[model samples]
Target: MDTNHNKSEKSFKIPGDWKEQSKQLKEKFSTLTDHDLKFEAGKEKEMLERIGNRLRKNREEVLNIIKEINLS
Candidate 1:
């Protein structure tokens, strides 16, 4: 219902999958810089926030895009 809440939900389901998620992100958003893709341990929110800002999208939208990235 809310932006922050959506971000929370998206991240909640994948707490330990950041690296895999980041890899999937690279396949989809090729333009993302190394810094943009870096998911430092314990900094997932910062990672998502940076990505959301770069794409000019809300957290939910960012989450939605990445959610479609099937891990391989």
Candidate 2:
């Protein structure tokens, strides 16, 4: 089994309600700037990388943060 596969399996796409989720995330993590949260459809990995670098988090952690505020 490839551990890399496990990492990819844990990755997630931004939800359809991402605008709302983005608002919540900004409110929750004040350090996150607009640039850090910039997202484009089919480019979630890059967006997550930006967010992770700014927030000092890994991809999975960023996904978890989004999940926590994903309710719409």
Candidate 3:
């Protein structure tokens, strides 16, 4: 069993209130549209990919941004 692949897939986690964090992200990143930030259940990876593409960032960068925003 390839546990590493599964772990990476499920690695990212929502740190705090996603709504509030997403709002902050939108404020910081004007290019992100509603569609980019729109999160669906069990679709976290997709949402991150959208945000990463819009921001020209990688998955880790997106995760870090979300974490930093939630901390602030």
Question: Which model scores highest in lDDT?
Answer: 3
Tens-place lDDT digits, model 1, residues 1-72: 555645545343453466787776777777676798786766777877888888788778877777666434
Give the lDDT of residue 11 in candidate 2: 44
TM per candidate comes to: 0.61, 0.77, 0.83
Write model 2 residue lDDT over 1-72, tens digit each, in one string: 556764645446777677777888899999988888887777778888899998999878988788778753
Looking at model 2, the pairs that clash are none
Where does candidate 3 have its weakest 10-residue lDDT segment? Answer: 2-11
Deviation (Å) of 59 in candidate 2: 0.9
Ranking by lDDT: 3, 2, 1
* TM-score for candidate 2: 0.77
lDDT of 3 at 17: 84
Q: Which predicted model would earn the best TM-score?
A: 3
lDDT score for residue 33 of model 2: 85
What does candidate 3's lDDT look like per residue over 1-72, in tens digits?
A: 666664645546677688888889999999999999998887899999999999999888988888789788
The alpha-carbon lDDT assigned to residue 19 of candidate 2 equals 73
Candidate 1, residue 4: the lDDT equals: 64
